[model samples]
Target chain A: MGSVVMHNVVSVDGFIADADDEVGPLFEWYGNGDVEIGAGCTVSKTSAAYVQPMWADLGVLVIGRHLFDLTNGWEGSPPAGEHVVVVSHRPRPEGWHPEASYFFVDDVARAVAKAGELAGDRTVGVAAGDVGGQALALGLVDEVAMDVVPVVFGSGKRYFGPVDSQHLLEDPHVVVQGDRVLHLRYKVRR
Target chain B: MGSVVMHNVVSVDGFIADADDEVGPLFEWYGNGDVEIGAGCTVSKTSAAYVQPMWADLGVLVIGRHLFDLTNGWEGSPPAGEHVVVVSHRPRPEGWHPEASYFFVDDVARAVAKAGELAGDRTVGVAAGDVGGQALALGLVDEVAMDVVPVVFGSGKRYFGPVDSQHLLEDPHVVVQGDRVLHLRYKVRR
Candidate 1:
């Protein structure tokens, strides 16, 4: 079976925003790492030529209702096994997914289990809120990767969904190419 | 007197880091914004040519010890009508300033008050934190401005020390730029 992973860009401190559903400037450049996040500025560092292929590798997407909604709707579940899933109590809209399809399971283990079964030989990933913590809590996740930004968010929604010493996770690998970013990958200890 | 404003880059969830300071891969291109945050492979964005003149207009610098230590040391006190007040119970090292440049105060109020006195005709720009929040709580700080980032930290040391709400703080004058950065400015409302 392919690995079930939870990944997202995170900041220092813990909360996401000061109030409301505010997602600050994330990426300024789409093709390049120099995309803009906020208003209407175009930024680039990692070009689309380099990142376009990265999206092609994602097999299955698991996310919270919040994240699912953020994308307006996960239509066109990517090529090469881009199966989308949502973890929420809400009912799915009609024809949310067409061909490749998507799924939403309320239970954590069930969701991971379903993703695992559906992943076939591909990876299953989750995004949004405490889903990562939930997956980890249930011992469902296999790998954890994060891109660390040097900005400090003082208050809002916290991200560390559930990180207790109980997990005892180890085997950390870091990828550093820029000052404003550090990509760290980790595997669950047991 | 001077205007006390807050400027920061926060995550969507409000944290600066995950459980162990995992920021994810957001800031790979440091200079991707008109406003840059910390140590990176890029130059400080806000410190551009246009901003150089603004520095001379600054009167006081308010910062918590966490920030004070993070920047290594004070920026050699503010230009002319300025004082770099480092909020801490312990004393600061000598020679941090050229003249009677720096002040380490035990009381947030005392520090702000001295800062205000020193800020003859300029604004009291602050890198506010817990103690800075204390000053704001005590009705000293006049304004707050922050740069809201995109990602979520999930957990870490927060900005303010703590609060029960004194019914202060005005509505934020929020400006959403194309860079996905929110320039939110708040006033001390009575």
Candidate 2:
């Protein structure tokens, strides 16, 4: 059986995006090929050796409609060729096809279930902020990985919108990325 | 000449305390006999070998009246015996004395100035949540040091409150302390 996981980079103040909707500085440590993150410290290593294998194990992705639109439906091919389930109230965009591994669902639970069905033996990666937060609130997520950047933007959209309940997390797997990026992974306690 | 620095331990959600106003688990990494913090890392060393030396150089400490009441004027001996300036609008508490190196003032600027005058050649540390946020907002803080614990409280007091302006911080000093704690230091850009 596969698990569901969520990951994102957040600021020191816990904001995923600023007032201007900019996530560049928060992701400054990512997307570069030279930076390595693992083993509790940021050291130089090949991403293919450490990161690519994890992405290879992700069989599906659950995301919000906003993120789907932000990346143009991931240009027809999502990361690692994983199936994508976009949760939205709106109708699917024009000329969408299931053969392309994209599904538009109305709610979060259905999306998670659909992703589980689609994933077979591999894990489902939840990528949207609100969708991931909702999954965590519902106790549907198994793990959370965060890349905490050393920046405080004063005010912005919190990654966890307004979860009413408290969920404890187990001891985390922590690593430093680049010079100052903190990479933390925790198992959600049910 | 002296510099003004603000330091605090916060959760992953940027909370300094829980809703019940307790700082227990967030500071569990502190107070143990074998932890030392410096240049953004928490190492295993005696307090005298690490923390006390930093406090020994602090000539003054600017704090809010709320914190003064919380700790009973830091038990009449501020950290390092630094001259303590308590910022408040209310009258000083009855039986307060200057011989204890404590002063109560009505405004933030006057408190900073008095701290500067008292500090002389040594640095001044600002130790109140609202006062530190206010100093950062007014561009009076020279640096910020945070001990980031791995826990995430859903909500609490933000160390940086309603700052009227945005202040950019340069690259930070970071270190992992005692397994799960992160020590971060950032210099405020003027």
Candidate 3:
């Protein structure tokens, strides 16, 4: 019913976050799109227009329990959309949080299924991390998108979950998002 | 003195080589400048001119022992230059097979020092893997360069080596290498 897409910003070395779990700066390119980056660096205007449509078109978001906990249940407004599903081994929290709407599912397949039901014909965006990798391994993900940041974390959480076997991705749509950020979009070959 | 730079082509998922240790197809974009990548994907001409200077500027290449063994001592010619240093814990092999100039060193610092000596005022490039990561961790690497290929290996060897802590990098020189490859250059902040 809907496509499942995984998206996130990662360093050139594929670190999604630093050891301290700082992801705010990896997304700094989003706030400043017209700054001079470094020598031999140039931003393409085509890359600048990628974000807005992505947010508007996303009808559902499926994330992991860890991400849900890290953001404190998104404090009500998760970046993706109004309908959010968190894949968690634990049951739903007892307290009511008015900040965001979240559906807790124990597994990735169920999360995708629930997200598709909630999204209708729209797209279901899979939040980054181990959840995304699980989706990829399960052949439930349709696309993988990333804003490849210029920073090198040297250590931290990787965007790709460790898959035992190889999973080939179709050639990506590569574009310079900002002066230093590269936006890469790939269709997962199921 | 010479700058020690680490360079490699990696899939968007951060895989440098496949499980079988094959790196040929990950670099296919360098040969085919124009081809339909995947759905809605096309090669950009601006991304085509990124190879020559990278190879010409390298003076010495510092690689790991595993890579040296994999190539059987680079058979004929190493990609970076004639003068190469291999970082290994084992003893030097007996007799040369007439390929490239190779120096075996046990430590990362020694390899960098040797490469610097051999390179003169030129740059010493570090082949990706344990050697590159070791250089980065030791604060000996000056630059980190990568050709971000559009494919996803899902599983394979990563470009980074295990470090005790995180190493942050400065703003990078970003350019489109070829139709589907993005060349990223980062100056390591020592």
Candidate 4:
């Protein structure tokens, strides 16, 4: 089975977006530099070196329904990954990007399991938020990755959702500094 | 005049402590390593190198009334700095540590000014929370320093307090990895 990495670009205050779903400046690093990493994305050379390979190895992405409706499942083509598993109560919208490889599962565990099956040896990337929090609490996520931006969002949608208990992570094994972001990766302590 | 640096050990979620004023695991890094940082504090050598000089240059410490009450103002002997300025409407307790250089000021700005007067050429360290937030909003803070511990506090007393607006910070000039903490410093963008 492939490793599941819960990831997001978070504010210094740990918010992925505001209550209204505005990401604010969280994605600024994607366009802040001259280095291009395909799909119209450009980032600092340090960030490209740190993130490009991760995107290349991503085979499946698991996200919550809110995200699916937000970008219409990234127009049926996720930023990375060949397949997408959306944890939603409703089925995929009828006749919407029928050729795209997208799966809708109501439960988070099943969604991750399906993503794992699709990913094989490739990495499964879980969008950080409610679904990611559930997967992490259930001990399904192997790593936690964050592209930490410097801005502080005092109140917004949290990256970890409403995690009731604390989760310990090993010291970050990867710490890379980019133009306006810091990339950190930590293994989920079992 | 000395620089006013707002500093705190914060959770990945940006909380300095729990609602009940308990730090929980946020202070774990202070005792998790072998390098002694004086005052019976031991931390990773990396952290010591990054934090020791910053502490050595501290001339005054500014804190909110809540923290003053929590630790009784650290029993009139602050962790660092020669003088402590407490922002409180009520005056310091009658004859409480009169021998210690502790000053009581009701307003955050006034407290910072008093701290600066006491600090002179040395740095004025402000404890992050409500008082620090107010000072930053008033444009008194020169830098923001965080010792980010690798744990998520789903909700708690925020490090930035109730900052209603976004504050921009320059990319961190300092990024030091310690045993269980990441030391980061960012200048408050003017």
Of the candidates shown, which would achieve the greatest DockQ relative to the real structure?
A: 4
Q: Estimate the overall C-alpha local distance difference test score of candidate 3.
A: 0.75
Q: Chain A of candidate 2: what's the TM-score?
A: 0.86
| Real A-B contacts recovered, model 3 | 0.62
* Model 1 alpha-carbon miss at residue A6, Å: 1.3
Clashes of 1: 66
Instruction: State the DockQ of every prediction.
Output: 0.07, 0.33, 0.45, 0.74
Residue A179, model 2: Cα distance from true site in angstroms: 4.7
Better of 3 and 4 by TM-score: 4
Candidate 3 residue B50 Cα shift, in angstroms, is 1.5
Better of 2 and 4 by DockQ: 4
RMSD (Cα, Å) for all candidates, in order, is 11.1, 4.8, 5.9, 1.2
Looking at model 4, residue A179 earns an lDDT score of 91
In model 3, pairs of residues that clash are A76-A99, A76-A100, B47-B177, B47-B178
Which candidate comes out best when scored by lDDT? Answer: 4
Every candidate's lDDT:
0.55, 0.72, 0.75, 0.90
The better candidate by DockQ, 2 or 3, is 3
Candidate 4, residues A146-180: lDDT per residue as tens digits? 99998877778888886756777888999999998
Using DockQ as the measure, what is the rank order of every candidate, best first? 4, 3, 2, 1
Kindly list the per-residue Cα lDDT of model 1 for residues A155-188, writing each as its tens digit.
Answer: 4544547544234334244333232343445666
Note the residue pairs that clash in candidate 2: none
lDDT of 2 by residue, A33-122 (tens): 454443222333543344556677889989888888888786768865368888999867787654587888999999999999999989
Q: For candidate 1, what is the recovered fraction of reference interface contacts?
A: 0.08
TM-score of chain A of each: 0.77, 0.86, 0.87, 0.98
